[model samples]
Structures are given as C-alpha cells and as structure tokens.
Target: MVAADRNAGGIRGQKAVFVGPHQLLRPLGEGGMGQVYLARSPGLRLLAVKVIRPEYAEDPQFQRRFQQEVEAARRVTGFHTPPVVDAEPRGRRPWMATAYLPAPALGEVILRFGTFSEAGVRALGAALAEALAAIHAAGVVHRDLKPGNVLIARDGPRVIDFGISRAFDATHLTRTGMVCGTPGYIAPECIVSASVTSAAADVFSLGCLLVYALTGRTPFGSGEPAQINRRVVYEEPDLSGVPGTLRPLVASCLDKDPARRSTATTLLGALAPVDPGALLSPGLLAELDARERQAEADLAAPQADPPALPVRTWQSLSRRGLFGLGAGLGAGAAAAVGVPLLLTRRTRPTGSAATVGKPVDAWGVDAAGTGSPPAGPEPLWSKPITGMTVDHQLSLLGATPVWWNEGMGAVGYDGTTGRQAWSREDAQFFQVQNDLIYGTSLDFAGLVWLNDKAESHRSPLVVPAAQRDEAAMSLRVFGADSRTVVLARETSLTGGGIVAGADLGSGAVLWQQEITENLAVSLARHQDSMLSGSGSSMGLVADGRCYFEDSGVIHAVDLRTGASRWQATGVTSAGVPSRLLRTGGLLLVVHGLAVVALDPATGQQRWAAPATPQPIFGCALGAGRLLLSGAMGTAYCLDVTTGRGSWHTTVGVTTAADRGADYQAPSAGEGFFGVPLPSRPSGVAVLDAADGAIRWVVNSASDEGRWTTAAKGGTLYCASATTLRAFRAGGA
Candidate 1:
C-alpha cells in the first residue's frame, strides 16, 4: 500500500499526482524579482508536498525559502502542529512534504456541520491559541492564520500550511497586494503592511477565526478585497453571534494594536480547563472518519507517473491502516503522537528494582463504607431466583446489588437483606454515579438513569440510531460525573472509538473526542474475559477522570467534557487493568511485569512499582496502596507514594489459569480481591486486603453452568444461574 513517490506530474488525461511540468497556471504574483504561479494540491495528498519546476529549484531565493520553511516547521512540534516529514529542496524539481491531514478545513467543517456550539468555539480558540503558542515559541510566525489554514482534526485543530508556502510565499504575497493572510481573517495590521506581521497578527486572525467559528461569518464581512481590507482596518468586528462569555477574549484577540492583543499563552491559560474534545457532534466526528476513509479511497485511484526526480518519501502501516500515522503525523493531525498510544519501555521505577526474595511493606485499601469489618470474610445472605441469572453481571448501586438477568434485564436487590428492590426489564444497568443508576436500553441506543428512589429518566442517543438498523455499533458508558455521563461508540472492540459526554441533568451530548486509537484496548486489553467491577471491560474512573490503557499509552480523560486531561504514553504494558488507574493519590500504569506510578494531575511518572514473582494480571487501589495479583495464586501490595512493597504473598490454588488467563482482570472491592479459579468458570479465590492471605474460596454447584462474582462496598457477591450470595469480612 505504501509506494514511494512515483514520478509525479502524471499524464494530462489521468489523475495528476503533482502539477506536471509545463502545466499552465494562473499568475498569482508578478514582481521585479520573480513571478509566482498558483498550484492546487489534491485533497488526499499523503504529504502536503510543494513541488517546484527545475528552473525554480535552482533559484537561490526559492531554495532559501524552501529550506527556511523546512527548518521552521521542524522547530515547531506540538499536538496542534503537523510535523515536517521529508524535503528535497535542491532536487531537479524541489519539493517538501509535511504530514498530510485528512480532515476538512475549518471553513468546510463549519459549512457542513453548521456553527459549532458556544463551548466548541471556545475549545477551538484554546486549541488554536495553543498552536500559535507552539509556532511562536519556535520563533516562527504563521503569517496566514485563517479558517482554511486550520484543519479541525478528530483529536484537535491543526494549524496547517504554516512555514511552507511556495506559491504563496511572503515575498510574493506582498507584491500580489493580497496581503500576508486571508482577506476576512487577516489582522488589520497585516492588511495595512505585510512587513509588520508578527505573532500578534496571528492572534488577531485567531479572534477573527473564533468569531467566524461561533457566528459562521467573518468578523469583517466578506466583500471585494479592497472593501474587506477597509472594513478590517476601520470597522468594529461583527460579534453578534459570538457567545457573550467568549466575546471579551475574542474582542481582545482582535485588538487593532498587536501589542494589545492577548498572547496565545495567555489564551491557553484562560481556556485550559475547557474540554475541546467533548464539543463536536456525532455527525461531525463520523464525517472526520469518513474523510479519512475517503482519503484512503482516493489513494486507490490508479497512480500515474510524473517525470522529474520525484521527491522520495517513506510510508509504513499503523493502527490507522496503511499510512501508519503513528510513525509520522498521518495525512496530518491524527498522525500526531497523540493518535496512537504506544507502550514505552523506559520507566521511573519506585524504590529500587524489586528483589524476588526481599521483604517489603504490605498493601492496604480503604473503601469507606458503613464501618470497619472483621478480619476474615463472613457470609451475609443468599437468595434464590427461579429465572434470569447471568454470573458476574453484578454491580452495587448504593446499598443495593443489581444484576443483569438475561432477556429480562436489570434486577436489583437490597444489599443487607437480599430483598428484591426493583427490577427494570426495559434497560440494563452499567454504572452508578451521584446516587443514580445509569443504564441503557436493551439495544444500547438510549440513555436511562434512576435515582436511589428508583425514579428513572430516559434520553435517546445521537448515534446508534435504532430506526436505521445500526447493530454493528455498540455504546459503552464511561460512567457519569456530576455534570456529564460519557458514552463511547465503537463498531468493534479494537480501534476507532468516539467518546461523547452527555449532560447529567439534561442528557444532551455536551462534548466528545474522536479517539481513533485502540478503544477496546483502552477499555479492556489487559483483562480480556473477566471485566473489572467498574462496569467497562478494562478502565478506571476516579476524581472526575477516566483512565484507560490503549496500546502502550494511558490516557486520562476528563469526565466533565470527555477531553483528554493528559496522556502517559510509552508505558510498556505489564499487566491487565486497571492498567491506567488513579488510586492511592497517584496514577498507576501496569505493563510488562511492573506498575509505574504517575502524578494523576500531570501523568509524570512518579516511580515504577516493585516487581512481583509472577506476571501481573489483576490490580486494585484503596487508601494509598495498590494490590496486584499474578497467576500461581501470587499477589503483591505496596505503598502508592513510596512504591515500597508492604507485603507479597502466594495463597493456595496452584491450578493452571485458563488460556490467556493473565488477560482476565480480577474483581476487587470492600477489602478483598478475587480471581476465578478456572477449574471451571464457577470457582473463585478471594484474598484479604490487609495481607495477601486467602480469605476463602467458592466452588460453583455442578448444576450451575457458569458463576461470576462482584466485590463492592466491603461485600463479595457470587452469582450463579439460580441464586446470589453476598459475603463480607465477617458473618453478617
């Protein structure tokens, strides 16, 4: 799929890879020094290649600009900036390539998707501001900052065509009288004099961009160039549609005086908390994916040869498919390092590399509950059901334990007495937050929630249209915080996940991010068969952040808006989730054989965990200590802050684990952790929280085909085909 740049400038009748030599072009600029011609690039071009004719390639001035743009681009690298890939300035036909972005220009998206929500515009502004900051920080000025120059990628906005502008170079721009930037979005100062353009000029353009983003019209109304320039230099911006909250910032960014404009850094600080990833509509996101697929399809069109030493480039495969965005930025923005999460082998290990026979501190957890219980588990209550029993489909909503009864739906029973609380056949419960039980309709197309009183609320989903027959798609809840309940839609378990957050009170989609990375892995790669009690396959939620491991990276997503707060990439996967867990005051990433602790706020590795005797499989956090279990019935406990081993122990049960047994994530809660014995799918080994002591083991009745368990609120719940039993630290 990845072929080198075959000779460009293909036949006139066939698809043109690059504008063939001798092709006629409109004279964009004519001056005393040189003449500039306009050349159009294909939408799906893998690299934003700027090709020049042999005559221009030898020009000292042209070569200088090409080399300068390449150097400037290489200096600027960030989530918002596309990287310079390959360049051949001195070649027969000089050419340079930047990561080709697949998404549409800002103007195109706005035209197709309509004006962004108020919050979305803010996010756009913040992201653009960050891009500007990176560009300026690299000492490069983006002379042209406009809607068309910015690509609204799945993850964030990408400032494109920054330094590399062959046909539209600064020297040519000034002579053409079109100014240094686009007419409507250009700063007044730039129109007045191109030579005076600076970073502040970009900020002015940013303001214009935001106004256009929010209102779908330029701050300076479009008209003849002279007229637009006159309005930009003399008139007050048309801010009627801009949000009142953002008007001030927009106004400041558009300040006529460059010195008076808000710096990108200041804008970043002011808008840092905004979750830009959460504001796009499902249609817009779907279109982004469609654009990528379309670009790939464009590549399939037969290649035509174009003579003249073609700019040689390289391409490799990646999760995104043949283009392999992870290596270099793919068609562009999604190719940024943020796209694919890779496991890093380097680590900032805690204490010292663990010594096998050495003694360390014991691990402990404190799931605050009714009270501290006895040392060992005690049977609480057992109830029999005549029908609808699916082992392990259990969750504790407050003082009630809810189980999924196949076909019939959710069945909830009181935690203390085992009396049936309320059964909802209409929906299946998945998460509980803010004293409310969150669930989805049997088809997973609608959102359903109920307060502790059993009062339920329902709202339809924007995606997964049931009427349209979208059975290939399934929505998974990332849990709800006080403000937003996030759900991610995916075709399958692996990649291309789009997470959207809905308002807690209104059930309206507030925000979402196109995380085309490995969604299933993020959700549960570590634990394949056994899912953590947290509801999803393999993710953790704490302090309003959802942490999950995808490929080799751990991403911390803000629950309020579904924006990624931080990404801890390169974490070599040691074990199953909560692989990306926030516990004991630190974020722990498990990959390979050890867990690494990172600052939850920054994702900076605090330390790598002490080693365990077996490959780590299961993990849980309580108080400030972590508990990780391994096969051969072995487990390790350690202080979260110090990474000091508290105690390591191996309980009974040396039976071989099931295939990919290490992939099954263990369930833990209250004060213990449990893993299936696998002798059958019905037996479980329970471990004490204070120490790695085996609290008790349960074997399913032969009649029960399969059994599953859930540990929550200091109680271990074992469910079979016809009965459910609750166990605690002591006899209830």
Candidate 2:
C-alpha cells in the first residue's frame, strides 16, 4: 500500500510524470540515474515507484541495468525482501514498483536506538543471513547489502534497494575501473577488483552490517571514500564493541580472503538457533504496527491524480524474459532515492493543573493485613540526588538507591537522607544481589564486585594468551548465598562459555562447566535451541541448588560440589529466556510464551502455565500471588503455588501505535502494587494486590513523568527524565 504524502508541497522542477499505470504523488528521492516517488495505482494501491531519470531512460545501457534490477528483485519472494509488484522497463520513463513499507532503515534504527544487544544482533544476523540465502538461491547477487538497504519492520528486517543487484546471467554494465557499493561496507575484492564481486562480497557486507548493529559505528571508520575503501581492502576491521559470541563468525565474514568467508547458507545455519522475534522491542513493534495501520488508512482514502503525463509502453522487454536475462547488470545507480527520514516532534509542556491531588493514606498494611492503611497521602521530603546527569532510572541496592552514569561508573545514595553513600568509578552497575553489587569495568578488564561499603573485588576471569586481547565478555550473576555465588560467563569467541560457582568472599572460581557447542550444534541435536529466558533475570539460587538454562534445558547444580543434580527440558525452544524467579519452593523460568515452575531441589516441573498472547515483560511474587505484565498492557495475577490465574486486568491506556509498549512490570509492596501509566498525564497507578483494584493514581502533569517507578518500604519512587520524586502514604 502507498503511504500518504504528508509533505507533498509541490514538485520543485519536473514536467513529465507518471510511470505506466501509477500516478506519481511526490518525489521521494532523486539520484543521478533515477528518481523514486510515492505513487498510487489506478486501484489506489500505494507503491514506491522508481523511475529512471529521463536522460538515463533513453540510454540503452541504463535501460538494461534498470531491467536487471527489476528482474533480480522480483526473483526474491519473502517477507525479508520487498516484493516487486509491477514494472514497465520498456516504457517512456522506465519504472519498477514494489510494496511500500513504511519503516526506518537499519541505519536509522541504529542511529536512533544506539547499538543493539547481543541477542538483538544475533537475531538481526539470522534474518539478514536468511535474506541473503534467498537472494542467492534465486541466482541474484545483492551487490549493495549495506545498512541503508535494510528496513527494520515489526515482522522482521526487510531487504530493499536492489537497484544495483543483478541476476547471474545478466550482463555487467559498469566499466572496468569503476568500483561500486558503500565504502565502509564494500568487500575487499570489490575495492581491489570490482570485476570479481561475488556472493562472498555480500557476506563481507553482512559482517559489516552485523558490526554496525552491535556497535553504532561501522567496522571501517567513516571518512573520505578513498580512505574507507583502503581500510576495507587492507586493515583489520574494528570490532571493539562486538560481543564475543558473534565476533568469531563476524571476523570470518570480514576475512580479507573471499574464500574464507561463509556463504549465506552457512551463516544462516549458524544463526538459525537465534529467535528473531526476541530481537524486536515492544515499543518498536508497536510503532511499526501503527505505521502500517496509518498507511492502510491513508491508502484507503480517496486519492486525486497529480499533474501527470500519459502512460507509454514498449514491447521489447517482457516481464518473464527480464528474469531470464544473462550476465547480470553492474552495480551502479543514481544515489538511492525515496528513502524516508523520520523526525520526532515533542508537544509543548502541559501545565500542572491537571495533576492528581494527594492520594489517601494507604500504607503499613502487611501481607496478612495486620496493620491498617495510611490515613492519607502525605508529602515526603523531595531530596534530589546530586551527580545525576543524563537521567537514569534508579534501582535498589538493598534499601539504598543506586544508579549509573556513562563514564561515571555507579553511585549509591542513602534512602532516608539522600546523602551519597558510596561510588565505584569506571564500572557500570549491572545487578544487585544480597549485599554485593555486580558490574563490569573495562578499566579493570573483568567483572567486579562491590560491597555495600563500596569496597571493590575483581573476579578471576582470565583469558588465554592466544586469544585476542580485547575479547568482549559478559556475566550473568544468578545470586549469592552464604558461601557460594552462581554466575554464567560468556565470551564472544565461545558462545556460552561457562557456568560456574564462585566463592562469595574471595571472588575465586570454585567449579565451572564449559558449553562447547554453538547454537547451531544445540539446534541440530535437540531440533530447537533452548536459548530463551528473561532478558533481565538469568537464573536463581535456592535450596543449595544453582539453577540456569542452557540450550533449552533448565539445569540444577550443587552449589558446593558443582555437580549436576538434575536437568529438565522444554522451557523454551528459541530466544533467550525472559526471567528466572525462585519463590515458594518453586523455581520459575519464563521464556517467550512458556512459563515453567520447577522444584528447586529436583529440577522437576511443578506446573507450566499456558502461553499468553503477548510476551510477559515483568513478574513479581508476593502475598501468595504472582503478577505478570504483558507486552500488550495486560496485567495478570496468578496463585503463586498452582500457577492458575487469580485475576487479570487491563491496567493502562494503549493505542494502536503504543499498545502495551510502555507497560513495565508492577512493583509490589506489602499491600499495594505500583505500575507506571504511560499515557497522557503520565502517572503511577497504585492497585490493591489482592483484588487488582485501583486504589489511587499518582498522576503527573506532563507525559515526561512516565519514566520508571520502583516501590519499597511503602514508598513509591518515580524517576523522570529530569528529576526523581518519592511519595509515601499520607501522614506516614
């Protein structure tokens, strides 16, 4: 469907218009050889129609190349690539029409969201690899497979801009000396000798794409084309921030020798175990859905024909014959046109007059209702924590609040006085467990542990001398008991390196188990890779057992002896697990649609909850209840022991553009649960945990107040972009 031209002011300068049966709405983009437009068919289907520049339209050479692009693109048929709808290569203004997808380019997503996580990168790699495989299977080579050509959509990443792509049998159109492709992503052979460009070159480009996805920067530094081209041909790629799990494969793809690079099929096989759906954030998916709905609505509206010329036809090139053309066309086109640029505009600040008044006293109620609720909502001291720059939501380090700043490590503040308690420089706080805070610091070259007093201890994470010096590493600490701490450590070089039990006091490793197989191996053995889990909670320690997931199996290990106690399967088949919680003698692991509760001692399944329509974002266990917040804004409370639903409620305002996109897991206190309201007049909804009834909504004046909320000690703490505010029961 064609997207409405919201910015169709006027064509700057152009006389002849209209291509075949499509009427041009607005110039989407213009390049030297062609111009793309947002156009509509007679039936009003929206399409992105690329029409060769008038000058090039008349060139027999350019005509053949344009025809080749249409044919090559038509050969790809899947959700990963935009489908060619119609084409008139022999017309007066040769043009090709493809499905119009209203989404940002991968480059734009990277620019806006910064770098993706390891899981996200893996998902992206898998999708692009599958796309490349399809392109190759059709005997076509996408010579220009860079970030700009990849569109991020709700369903998956879509490959576009096949202007330079050609079928294997088509003739090469470029002269010997001309090099093609975006410099930073160009393969070595393309820079050194463009004549030998092959499918491997596309593989090299995929490596560049993966690097850009993991680190906001390209492998080759951006600068003068000559310089970047030189680096692409000679220098080792800069994969500084690329996760270790993917570094080896990415490095192989970027190999200087084309023979060393993996084929699209091989790469797809390697990443097949990764779940692509897990890569997309709810917010982005919601935005994509909104765009699609808007586009559908726009196309459904009546469309008026803009100033246009009559459609002309030529009979020389038939659609079927174009697909059979030999030798393929060279990779050259006018700069890519018709690409959309998204801009966000914020509304003026709303006044505080609409803010919700002080709420009624609702505190001091225990789990069994031994204490009464507060008399009324009372104002607590609003003390600003100093040294906070680029507002980050505060997490609890016990009762003390802690936060991290880029380049500033972690800082903690006293909960009562708001006085600075301690600070750890050069380390970013990851999680808090018991009295120890775990974080990573490149300055220390490994994971570090900080005590409540801010004393630091480094873990013994040694690297082999033969390995690269700057190998990227990540740690997921499950929990720490009296003597042992259970954690999982992964290096990019090896997929899931090790799950170990470490000494709680000295940070010394006690026992470790190596995971030798990659995701591909795991999938081949089990038919599904059980990589899914909560992105936030990896595993949990309870009953002298260390619980964690590996390749779809939940494993229980003896904390003292490091021996495998038992293992249970069927938690998740793909995607990383969402969360692992231990409560009420049950070890719960939420992965994608499945929520399994297991006996902590025997690793036996107690009860498995049925899948939900949307993924569960957060879950809290308290007051004999387990509360879960879904991506679609649904809140569910289940009986903690049986995993049966006790109550379900739709808690917040959701729209097509942002359905449950802003829903965060509710924070549970003794008697109340707090959830952030992301809609207009942003606020926190305080609900009765027992019945799912709204007790009060602490509303803010502006939408900016919808940041993050945390509840503790009958107090609700709200962190906005600009400030942090705390609220308590009235007259507390």
Top-lDDT structure, candidate number: 2
Any idea what lDDT model 2 has? 0.57
Q: Give the alpha carbon lDDT tens digit for every residue of 1-732 in model 2.
A: 111233242121112134565655443443323446666677778787765533334446556776776777788876688888899775545678888888867765655455688888888988898888888777677888876688888778888876444421122333213465666888888778666758898899999989888876679875346777898887899989987878899999999999989988889888768767766776667767887886676565444444333321334433211111000011111110121111121111122111111211111111211122222254354555445554344566667666554223777666675667877776755455665667666653566777756778775543333331222223456567877877654432213346678776666777887643232122111100111111234456778877766545667888877889998754443223336777777887665434667777777777755343333556666666766665434455666587655554444544333421334446766666666654555666666676665565666564353556556667766666555666672223
Candidate lDDT scores, in order, read 0.56, 0.57
lDDT at 490 for candidate 2? 43
Task: Please give the distance, in angstroms, between residue 556's alpha carbon in candidate 2 and its true position after superposition.
Answer: 0.5
Off by over 4 Å in 2: 1-204, 207-379, 385-393, 405-408, 440-442, 445-447, 453-473, 493-495, 515-536, 656-663, 701-706, 729-732
Give the range where candidate 2 is weakest over 10 consecutive residues by summed lDDT.
323-332
Q: How much lDDT does candidate 1 score? A: 0.56
RMSD of each: 23.0, 19.1
Residue 370, model 1: Cα distance from true site in angstroms: 35
- Tell me the spans in candidate 1 whose CA falls farther than 4 Å from its real position: 1-378, 389-391, 405-408, 430-436, 442-445, 451-453, 464-473, 491-494, 521-551, 557-564, 572-578, 611-613, 652-671, 700-707, 712-714, 730-732
TM-scores for all candidates? 0.45, 0.52
405-454: candidate 1 lDDT, tens digit per residue: 32236677887788888877777655544456666777766678776447
